[model samples]
Target: MVKSRSETRAHILETAARLLDDEGAAALTIRAVAQAAGLQAPALYRFFEDKDALLDAVAEHVFTTYVTGKAAARDGDPVADLRAGWDAHIGFGVANAALFGLLVTPGRTSPVAEAGLVVLRARVHRIAEAGRLRVPERLAAELVHAAGTGAVLTLLARRPEDRDPGLAEAMFEAVLARILTDAPTPTDTSPDLSKLTVAERALLAEWLDRD
Candidate 1:
């Protein structure tokens, strides 16, 4: 049976992704993908405008799969959710170095990366609503995104054996400390105000001034 247009497109993307994963982006040329997919080079142009377009689609496909899996496995605690997301992001980058590099190349605005950022923003917003976020939600999200991406890139730059096992976790803790409050915002009916020290009171005043 002949494949429909959508089926053919999906097949092409899947083939290209397999080639990319197995051989790296250097081997993901239009001619190479065409040969792998058992189609004429010109036929690939029917689904993708060019090599860059095909690579973008492959990145989107792979990243969408990763994001979908994480979404399905989401935990209930917002903070824990963010931590899990961070770990998953680093793990994906480490496991798929070439694809991760393609998705996060400097100056490239990838749809896949944007989708991940959207999830991060939602998680940060939840933290803010819970009064645990120290910074503005958008700023908190950006900080986390930047730190996470940088951590992955830094680790990927080193030999696998030389990479610090604690690097990603340490970076995450540093970012978290900057963005999350030690406790929920104080309330009128809350525990004794005398429990807070002068330094703690000053920190609370500073937090209130952030708005």
Candidate 2:
């Protein structure tokens, strides 16, 4: 049966991702991917501009799938949600080192990555609203992002047997220690607003207890 354009593109991406996982990026070639997908090399250009473009798409495919799966797993408190995001990012980078490399290539901005930063920003914003954040929201988000990326890349550099399982969590804790505060904000201790309706009071309590 003939495939639609989107279906063909998804098939090509899935095939390329399999090859990337089996062999490192250095060994991946357009011809190989096309052959694996049972398509002529020229046909692949219908969906991708070139090998580099194909790799970028594959990176997006895998990383977006990983993030979507994580999002559906479960919800949590603010701090737990932040840690979950950190762990998911590190896990994806390490598990898909070659694709991760493409996603975070210097001088190349990925929309998928920017979306991830948006999630991080939201998570940090939640903590800030809860009065658990000690630093600025932007700074807190960047710290978590930088730390997660560095930890994953550093671990990927090592032989799997030589990698420390605790390193990623330790880096997360270090970032958290620098950013989180236990003290409540001034408004938390302010005089109660008896004039507030029940619904407003409940919403305010939910926001304050987010951490």
What's model 1's overall lDDT?
0.89
Each candidate's TM vs. the true structure?
0.80, 0.80
Clashes per prediction? 0, 0
Candidate 1 per-residue C-alpha lDDT over 124-211 given as tens digits, one digit per residue, 9 for 90 to 100: 8888878898788888999999999899999999999999999999999999999999998654586676889999999988998995
- Model 1 clashing residue pairs (backbone): none
Candidate 1: misplaced stretches above 4 Å?
68-72, 187-211
| lDDT by residue for model 2 (1-211), tens | 9999999999999999999988878756889999999999999988889887887788789987887776745355788889888888888898888888877789888777778899889988988888888889999998898899899989999999999999999999999899998675655567567989999999989998998
- Give the C-alpha miss distance for residue 60 in model 1, angstroms: 1.9
Roughly what TM-score does model 2 have, to 2 decimal places? 0.80
